[model samples]
Target: MGRKLMSTLAVLSLILQTISAMNVICYHGTWSRYRSGNGSLKISDIDASLCTHYIYAFVGLDSSTYEVVSLDSWLDISLNGFADAVALKESNSNLKVLLAIGGWNEGSAKYSTMASNSTNRATFISSVISMLQTYSFDGFDVDWEYPARRDSTNSEDKENFALLLKELREAFDTYGFILTAAVSATPSSADISYDVPSLSTYLDSINLMEYDYFGAWDDVTGHNAPLNGQSVYFGTTYAEYNLHSSVYGWIERGADPSKLALGIPLYGRTFTLSNSSSNGVGAAVSGAGPAGPYTASAGFLGIQRDFGRVR
Candidate 1:
């Protein structure tokens, strides 16, 4: 997803490449069930061997109490979505399943409000701990969209976001719960929203959302994730928009390389070409491609291993 955020739904294919073994993290968008036919995915359909970790995308935050709550109690709680997802561990003993709180839909203003105050943060942490315990979640994920990037949030969010992670780290440690966060790929958002060094100190993994360089919203068609920047964007600030720059940008900002998880989108954002012959990168596009059959939505929809040449 872009910082503009097309949808709260993201099938994050995060590969945590460590020195010893490759750890794959997959996100199960629970709402997929609402999609018709094969678009629907339940925990039972997962191949646990393929993933080292599975994240349940989005349980929400309550405005009144600042506590985390399931967005779909009927599916997550009553239907045993939580239990079923965690049960993937049984299929692969090394697999750890966690639940994410906060998404594009959850918005930033409230999280800003919740994180800035010690009393609200405490209440939020307590509820997270309770939910983790009750649902048997191995860990928790924070996908707050952004901390200070929105107009609704203030500058204090940069510091308060780190504090929230610090507090969450302390609480999660009591049960050996792993902590992770999904963050924006572009520096436009990252620079404004994150204190990378401070938050990296608390988070076990920092998942870099490294896709969405271009989407249906664009006038030109481009790679969703290019290892190197497109020539069209060259000499522009957007020239840094690619996997190589995004990852190293974090590393340059003092994030531990080992804790960095490279995230790629498992979806595509298509465009209807104004001139099909010019359908390469930077080609002019009329508008969004076409509505997906299963997703039943208009839009939603990258590159090589050359590292140094990209910049």
Candidate 2:
């Protein structure tokens, strides 16, 4: 086993060396937040060139990730608008418009159901692919809230999630379309139940949700994306707490970083505990911090609006 492990490490090192040449794909979160006063949104604030290879707009579907309703749920809102804006900036070239299915609030139940039945699964995939064809989406991102336990959603959903990905990969590959998934940041051997190597064989990339390391949810305070911190926290502050460490963790778990994209949140989490220290410790007052620097309290839309004005 030790000999086999070393051999695997050697191969991974080689893969790593080759992967750096691959583009560093980056994505923006929540396009609905970027609506301008005229109801027009421009993604120039994000700088299309910064996206090494592909850029994706994080779209929410019917308030759920798995329950993908109509394409209008995305096309009608700022998500599609953002895609068009980005596509226009890219000279109508492919920027890989991917609709992320499932989110923090949505669970893997929807995915499980979709994968359980063959006909329903085919219909779902067909609908999504058709949307991609109509709107020219490069691929789809499956964010199943979570697979296996240690967070929200059920552990049993892991296998079903894998099955869905397998089918998606087979279908998408035929047309040269991309298929990526947003996987959990921290996953153990059996904890994930996802065959990483098998998954790597099929999909284009696996975006590790490296953000949200810490939040206001904990009884004790911590950075959301802390490095070398006791536990996961907000803000990708330290080397150990930031995206680098998260990426390393994924690499260690057999995921190829080349096929992995880092998730950066445009929005920051705020705590309003009166007694809390400004150093990002202790408790805070009941008041909430405004989303942006100037705004009183800006949500996703408000912030995106501010960003578009600057662009």
Give residue 36's error in model 1 in angstroms: 1.1
Cα RMSD, model 1: 5.2
Local accuracy by lDDT, each model: 0.76, 0.50
| Model 2 lDDT at residue 149 | 34
lDDT digits (tens) for residues 1-311 of candidate 1: 35336255434222232212577888667777666565666778779898888888779889889999989999898898889988989989998899988767777888988988999999999999999999898999898877886544566898899999999999888889999998887765678788999867999888887777777777787777788766564456367778888888888888988888877666666778999898777778998776566555555531111111223
- The top-ranked prediction according to lDDT is 1
Best prediction by TM-score: 1
lDDT of 2 by residue, 1-311 (tens): 11001110011100111124545555433433333343333454444444444434434343233335543355445455535544744642534455555555444455555666677667777877876777666678776555553343444565666677888888988888878776665544224556676667677887665555544443434454444544333244333444556567667767765786655443334544556454455344354443443332322113333344432
